[model samples]
Target chain A: MAAGEGHRLHRLGLVVNMVGGLRNLIFPLIAIAFGTSTLDFGYLLLVGIAILFIGFTLFFSWLAWTRFRYIIGVEEIRIESGILNRNARSIPFERIQDVSIEQKLIPRLLGLGEVKFETGGGEGDEGTLAYVSTEEGERLRELVRDRKEGAVATPAPEIANNDDGTADIRRFEPEAEPLFAMDTQRIFTFGLFEFSLVIFAVLFGVAQQFEFILPFNLYDIGAWIGIVEDSGIDIDAISWGARIFGAMAALASLIAIGIATGLLRTFLREYGFRLDRTPKGFRRRRGLTTLTDVVMPAHRVQAAIVQTGFFRRRWGWHALKFVSLAQDSKEEGSHVVAPFAQRPEIDPIMKEAAITPETLDIGFRRLDWRWWFDQWALLLPFALLPIVGLLIFTDVGARAALILLLPVIAALFVWLSWRHCKKALDENQLYFREGWWSPKLTIAPQVKIQSIEISQGPIARLRGLAEMEFGIAGGALSIGGIPVGEANAIRQRLLDEIVKVDFADVNRG
Target chain B: MTDCAGFTPTAPLAIEEMDVNYKGFGAINCLVSAIQQRHISNMDEATETEELTRLHPDHVKVTRIVASLFMLVLIIPAIIAETAAYLNQESGPPNGVFIIPVLLIAAFFVLFMPWRRYIHRGFHMSADRIRIVRGYLFRSDTIVPFGRIQHIDVDQGPIQRRYDLATLTVHTAGNHNSTVSLPGLLHEDAIAMREEIRAHIKRDAI
Candidate 1:
């Protein structure tokens, strides 16, 4: 790593610490809102700030003081570093479940990569090595994996001749070779689209943040101008030139805000971005200050979720999330490799990760029946809420207020929900694919399932519909809107198959 | 989880099946609670010895008859109140007068239906395994090979004590949905069932 780059990284960390520490100062306000005593809230904030300060100081000092050294031995990669307390991490070869790499525009320009290590345990069990070059990261990963998998070996071959040497032939070990390399074109296409979307999202976020800062309602200005005429504020009495200038001023302000928002987003989202593969796992390191490194392992991942939002679908950009242990849900604890991955890039990555045509993508069954059942079941809440609203309004003018509100909201919800109940299942897995805007497909392996159950309510029974629930180590995801018999049959088959497999790593050998 | 990589166990074709019924019990209970305002004051006794003892010696048929009669007596008034309210809502009094009665009838209908269903939904145990298929809306079939049974517990509620009966529950490693209760089982039968399940577990372990 270059000394200049290291200095920049240290400065970025200090900025992040200072910004994050600001949260502690506001903690007392939250504590008071929650009904804590003022004294207690003050004490809480004091302790919190102290902890934050100490933690940030130690982290920044360590980053500045230490020099990182790494090496690949047979079947393992060892990273040794520390200023005061020397630290060494040794990751074994077989345990190297995933090796992925990424580079952002800045990192691409700087030729740096962030490497992550995913241990597939409970929280706080994983580690990451960040801000190294992409080439070194890939080389280290290859060395460890080849050594572990007992693949072909070739000692280092010198790419350059040294100034004073006869022949500067570098010896490369057998283990130090990359098993996979990404296509540059696909990566570039993906990065370009993702970079744009992130800029848009950040701008939107900033606009919402500045919503309260505006003193007047710019949205109501046109209507207000008409009102001014009605209220006898003689707009015709004012000069025509002044009116034109006022309108132009408003337009300029709006444009200026938009431009500022866009610029702020671009800088924040793209700062210090890089994605890369390490010896232990796939790594995504991003953010200038408060740098984040996400490491994901292959074996520990229980499911893969592919998401495509409305705009992304048109551009063929998508995101992938890995469902793993103790995450509460598939959406949580995910390592986002890219904010946007183009279809060409996505397809190959999926193929390499064993999540493509041969595996997860095969034999998916769309759950049309769930949509129908959900529509019917929705009637319960439809009936219940209206009745409650009527009852409440009858006495306290709640009805008048609710009647003016509830129908439109409820109707909109029902319409949107109807569009979102679609699902797909296959012989080996079930895809509970739903959502109108943010579509998510949850893939569950049959072997990991704990039980399968089918149930019906009185309304569902009348409709001849049943709900099928697939229970796994996590929790149950129920599919509604299938015929009772069909759901039962599917449930039975799943259970039968589940009982047949040995899930606790007993049969993998 | 240890691997015997090349080994695979044969799937069972079929096992001998036994019909067990606490017949119409769960459904009856569900309906009785719904339609009848007459709340059960003796549930503890009903679930214990009184209910269990009915399956033994000579009182099995007698107890069933007595329980049916009790439910009928409790439901008749609720039916009358609701029918009267529905038919004569205008002439005699407002429907509000019959609200309690209507609620009682609804309660009885809800309770007895499910109770009778539960009674009808008993486990069919054989020498090899136990199978349970349940749910009025979402039906599920749970198969527990007796060999896989880790332990068995014979539970007697206050009512079961009065009837001298017991409910048998089987536990296993994959025991997410493993409840096979012989609600009206005689004490001796419950003990025998427990022993049988325990023996299977022991054999499977060996």
Candidate 2:
């Protein structure tokens, strides 16, 4: 691990690259297999083409493996890659926000991991080492941490140094009590609430793509009916009660399948979910197949979000996430510290992040009443169009006019949302509580707020109401339908707090 | 003065001070009429105000030229359609009727709308923050504190360069409304503004 020397990835990366290449060729390989059964002389030509394709894939994978190299320097890490374009990227030690190690199913078995460097500059990982030995990844992470701390002029934490040129991987192990961990029972309870129909969609896609091997046409309803009759179940001769019972049985089976899929997905993703406080940050380790190890520093946590779904809220279950500059995943911008926890369980984690939890005595103020009326007025016309059309164009009688109930139901929802949406600004933090069914509470410190906007549309101006949108670093916090006076007061108050702090001092910790 | 819509523009009216007459309408209709009346009254308030600074006068001319170019895209196809219909003579309408309205609409958009938009947009800089107000139909007032600025950029397009105008954009760490741009400034003024804001921006703000 000499500085300024370029190192190639482990040779096992070639196997991983080849597997990725072959995965992309599956459709064409399947097509060729089907073609070989239909033609005689064409079979030899297809086989030759298939062999050439596999040879080319293997050649390219090997070439790519040979081309990729990374140089861990004293001040920066440089990566050189690309087959023809030849891309060289240099990331300084101070710019990197965090380092994570991820091991997918194959790499985990091979005792290899992918190291990702998050720069907090954009949407994706700034630098990555695709396949390296787990021990090497850990050593590289520690080296980068030491260099970054050195650049910041801060004393490095007490860890066994590698001054004698020996790798000490065990020095980075977690020794304190875990902040949060999910056992099998809690995971199963979480799975019950996460019922999904994704399995059915996957099954349908498989049937569509590979239906040529099936004996019957899958889409033909007549063929399905014929098969049912062949099984000695006459559809027209069945009793009404029996038909109702059969339909219920079908629905029950669908529910059962959905629950099974949810359980399988949850178990695979949250198998050994654990969160621990380490010297570097709050470290999270999870996943049965694709293990991910992420450490989010406490100072970088700009805001905290407590989320709960409709049923989960009823059962007193919540998830806590921290909004940081580094993204947790491609789709989620916040890191989930506790996927499933109760109010008492989440308090300590929030405390660790320096975010105050919502208390019972906090005064939360509601938005203007026009917030409800504005939504109702905007939606009622669209809802009335269909009901009015039914009443005027057709002779379906009064039953058709029952569609008018749609607007009433919509009005009820608008009222509920307006009632639930509230904001509370304490001495140091801003709390926004939104949503009726699946409520989300966002807590942002006043010093972290970047900008404040007070917007008024034509209708809002008439009602003397304004929407206040707060600009946070990695999250959105807005409260609409505030009276203009209050909106201005809040804006001034927040601005006064934002300008007083020196950001350099804030970043040092 | 009343325009084609029989609506008059007046001095800027605050919501509480205005008298909105809604004698016979239902609650929703009353709300709708109140908004319409306020919109019409405030239309002329786009004129100069005491605290805010209007964009350079040449901005109106630049906007007019750009709008006219966009109108060409619409007018060319419209003229072609009219000529083809006249040649066919069997199914199309009379020749001058269609072209007349289309040309009139294009003229209204190209000749008049730019000045209206130019009047409505204004920006003001205070000790610590910049406030921008724009759009007559959908008014938005955004304020960005100088301490929150991550970077400042002064950009000038080809047309803007000819007019000696530039746009100053300040970037913040916020995801929504992260970059606030104030266009239609003299090139030198934009640069000065950028430098001033840059001076206020502290290092490692995020």
Candidate 3:
């Protein structure tokens, strides 16, 4: 298996990973050397264990380099390797779920890439293949993908034609070049907002930490503020002056940080972002350093989430991620059609991916406003505390605390509901729109739903609300908390749809 | 009480014995009540029966309730009391030890008999599909077609080992809750049912 540029790149990765592990272990060892306690020593020991494991891995990897042999067969892909413990794995063409090709900076430089095969593992385990040359990975991906499609072709096309006569069947075809590529201009535009926020936060945090460095010292400002005529100087004015200067300095620093961070993240994430419509589904590739290629099976996509923020919405910029059968360790895993795309950019991908609002039966039974009202019940009492306390004390400190607490409480209440008060469903696919600061939209296929539950609490009952739980098969795809009426309607609808449909005829029905 | 035995499928099939309705305990009623408490309201009050049917189809729910009640009334109290006593730190008259044992034995007549009489039922498969209608408190009727069967698996466990019994798991594709595990069947009976379902699938395929 270790033959060509891909082999050299894999070896380099092994070396880099080993060094990284060692560096992390050295930090704790250094701390222990500086008179840290037994707990610290224990931590260091754990780190050493990891380092040792990695070391042993390097040794075994070398052994495998000699023993390994993989045959990308016509109907099956087989990997045979191991020194002391020999093992061989062979997966037939029909069972292959997805085949992907990826290339990172090193792989790009070396003209090599990695290929991964996803199989129908239940929940925890998926399939993977780590390293291959770019050309080899592409070749393997094409062969496996084509074989799987060819196996299922006769039935799928016939079913598709029966279901929707006008079905625009798109076959899986590998592209020589990427479907979408991020230009320098687009990257810069994407960076602006991120860069600004990062810069602002860093500046504000630094200013808060070393606030004493300001020209107007708190004590000096207080002395200047002679509030009681004979008591003290006008410190309030002095403090205000200092605060203004600090704010200006912070703002300037924020701008610089924002730009740099924004550029870096944008450049790295969408360096060569691509989304291609394949026969079975969509294949996505992005990244500069550690490139990732995700080939998603349309049948496995339980949900499609489109997210946009206030700024993003205004600019028509959004991101879409597909919720599929990925394991817990890969919870954030999704087939991203594009990173930071505008509405127009996302349109073609959505259409090609066969994710449309009309075809997908999304339930819109929103959680009643009462859901938000219940939160205020808990919120109002906690918020009233400082105000009640202030009424008794009437002191300056008490007054300020009371004054500050109101807006803070109000903000908390707003943010809490703003983020959590979600709209979700159990459709032919489950679709949801959630999140406050960084809002997201998600859609999932129904067959992937692990379980369905209907629940109602006393408070919710009084308000005529109920919650439905739809457990997606893979990790983190499961979403809950649709309204009572909506939950039931969705449940009923899903039962009507999912229960009666012949799974073998899923493509048709 | 409703039992699966009483269930008469609309189609033609063998009926070795039918248990259509559960007799006394209102197991479905209790479950429905419990389920009702967790949600704000039933999605459709008019179709509470339908919802129950969807939640757990009639035949399967009845068999489960009947079998579970037997365990609940006869076995659970003993297990619970013994477990509580074993787990309890103190020896006392009203605490885990004393209360639990009394509760276990008392449960046999007090809770067991009544519940056993109230709940417990089974279903019979007819031509076309299976019909299961059994519930004590909240009545439910479920009908499933044989053609809808995506896959089927037979399972045997240690407990079933003692009784020389097994369970049949039926799955329908696209339905998360497609599995209907039919238990409390004799080993031979289960094999026959498996063959029946297999034949049904084969017949429907064309």
Candidate 4:
């Protein structure tokens, strides 16, 4: 736990790396198991090859572990890695936006965690110290935070040593009231709303990948029918009512599987979800198996997005997210501060981020009426082409006319979206409300806008309307169908406000 | 159709004298009308003065050369395909039948389109910001404040160098529309613009 010295990762990381390498060979191992029956020369050769592969994996893991080292200097953290091709990356303390500690299932059992330093450069974590002791990770995070703030790198008082060398680190004491926390019942309800069919896709993939190991062909419907018939069911002579009931039962089970998958995934990801406001930043800790502790400073928040589905909105549930330069995960561009909350509950968290929620009395401007008409005009022809082709070329001529219903539905959707899409510019913030079914509200501060653009296509020019786009670091703020004059006025106003403030006072990303 | 000369007896007059008298008047009238029309259009242009500076005149030639090069890439393949089809067929249109239309279209694109593009592309500079206006059918006007510029780049290609032209690009922190490039500026102007923006960026650096 000394600064200005090189340190290696926990020794147990070699075991984790070896296990990870072996997991990649699982399919081939399974193939070998099924291919060989007798202990002949072929079996011996296969076994030898497998042993060699495992040996190589272990040797490489050990080599990598020995080669990797990190040094915490006064102004920067330098990481040296690679076996043959050496790479040394030094990240200045001021450039590091935040530090997060994550513990996967294996590492957690080994009392190790991965510390990631996010620089908000959009590429990814600038540096990561994998498989460090939990206490070491916490100490490193505190040291980086202190150095980033231009404070002396003093040891954090919270991480005290015990007489016996066992970690009794009090990670959470709940000194102040948490901004948001989800109980089991709330998570379950959220899981219900998140009903997913991804489990079916995963199961299908597994079945496809290992179909040869199955007793019968997985995709052959005749084989399944034979099995059913062999079990004393007369499929050919079954009544229509019984067939309908069987189909209903199958549908019900499919729904049940989907719901169960959603619940399982939600429980694994959102168990013990808590968000607390620390003096330094907002601390978010969650996950049942892979625990992640992230602290994002409030000033780095570029915008706030309040999202809800049609059903969730009806039931009064919304999710709050902060659009920061540091991403929460690979796929999520924003950090989810409140996974499930009501309006009143979300207001406090939004206030902490200095983003105001849409008020009832605030006037919102609707887009031009032509927005819907233009879309319908462009889409209706493509829709009619297929229907007309079916009507002319097929025997079901009159019935094909029923296909016109699709275009009707599309037109309705465009109309509804045009109705729902609205934008409001207040004295301090720009609010955009979009999506008809799943409404999302994005609130961005006026001064955070980096640039402005007003664009016009041929049609937009004819209509004397323009699309206005605002440039922010992390989030998107754009609205179309404003009159040309209004767009210019808005751009001038925003530019005036942007130039008035000295950027030295502002936080860049 | 009957000959019109037989029907002109009702309005016979001194055509040569009228033509001689009206020629001078018509020239003066056209000159006056052109000046009046130009004045009206100038008044209209003054109100919407978004594009303060146009791209260099030589950019039209550069664009034409580039477009012709691109057209040749496509034209060569098209000529080969048409020749192959003509030779493989027992009886069909002539060898140049398909290629003629392609050549005509390519000629239109290579000869005329660059001028349209040159007329549409322009940029305006203020003390605090730069506005770029581009595209003919799909016009876009982008304004980047100097205070927000993260960096500035002045780039020139071989052809651009021959024409003494360069492109100036300014990068901002935003993801969308982060880098706005204004091509076809005089090389000296582009470098001057980059230096000016760089100074502003340094002044505003945190």
Off by over 4 Å in 4: A1-174, A212-220, A327-331, A502-504, B1-51, B77-95
Each candidate's interface RMSD, rounded to one decimal?
Answer: 16.1, 7.9, 10.1, 9.4
True-vs-predicted CA distance for residue B37, candidate 1, Å: 28
Model 2 segments beyond 4 Å from truth?
A: A1-174, A208-223, A327-331, A502-508, B1-50, B82-95, B203-206
**Candidate lDDT (C-alpha), each:** 0.50, 0.75, 0.53, 0.74
lDDT against true structure, model 3: 0.53
lDDT of 4 by residue, A223-320 (tens): 99999999998898999999999999999998998899889999999999999987557899999999989888787787899999999999999999
TM-score of 4: 0.69
- Please write out the lDDT profile of model 4 over residues B1-206, one tens digit for every residue: 11111111111121222245445446544553443343233222112333257788788778888889889987998889888889888996866866888898887788657755665566778877898877656767788887766545555666777898877866665666777888888888986886676555444443
Query: What are the per-residue Cα lDDT tens digits for candidate 1 across B81-133?
Result: 76777786567544555457655565555544434334324344665555554
TM-score of 2: 0.71
> Per model, how many backbone clashes are there?
74, 0, 55, 0
Best-to-worst TM-score order: 2, 4, 3, 1
Which of candidates 1 and 4 is the stronger one according to lDDT?
4
Q: Which number leads on DockQ?
A: 2
Q: Which candidate comes out best when scored by TM-score?
A: 2
Question: Against the correct fold, how does model 1 do in TM-score?
Answer: 0.44
